[model samples]
Target: MIFYNGDLWGPMREETNSWFSRIYSARYAACTAEEGHRNLVLTMAMDLSSKTGKELELPIDVNDLMKGL
Candidate 1:
C-alpha cells in the first residue's frame, strides 16, 4: 500500500518533507504532492520509519523505474 515514510529536516530548507517517489508497484507507490517536485523517496523512508516505528522497504515499479529520470 502507499505509505508516507517521513519528512526531511535541515537548517536551510524550503520544504519540511518529501514523499516516496519511486515505488516497486502501483499499490505500493507513494501518495505524493500535487506539484510532484517535493516528493522524495529517501525522505519518505526516513519519515515513515520514525513516525510509524517500522522499517520501510519501498517497492519500485520496474517499468516506471526504466522510464524515470
Candidate 2:
C-alpha cells in the first residue's frame, strides 16, 4: 500500500493496528511496496509487532500502477 501523504498517520496507524490485531492468531503476510515515504516504516512496524505476520517487499511502483489505471 502506498500512502501519498503523511497527514493520515493517525487513521493509518489505527487501521493497521486493527488489521494486525485481527490476524494476530494466524499466519499472514504483509506485502508492501516502496510507494511512499511513510509506507515502509509503517509496514515494517506492523510486521515487527505481529506475532505471525511476515513482511514482504514487493517490487512494484505505485506511480506506474496509477498511470496504468
Model 2 clash pairs are none
Candidate 2, superposed: residue stretches over 4 Å from native? 1-9, 26-65
lDDT for each of the candidates?
0.44, 0.52
lDDT of 1: 0.44
In model 1, what is the error at residue 21, expressed in angstroms? 25
Could you give candidate 1's per-residue lDDT for residues 9-57 as a string of tens digits? 4542332222223332334324446334334545545655677676655
TM-score result, candidate 2: 0.26
Cα error, candidate 1, residue 36 (Å): 11
- Return the lDDT, model 1, position 35: 30
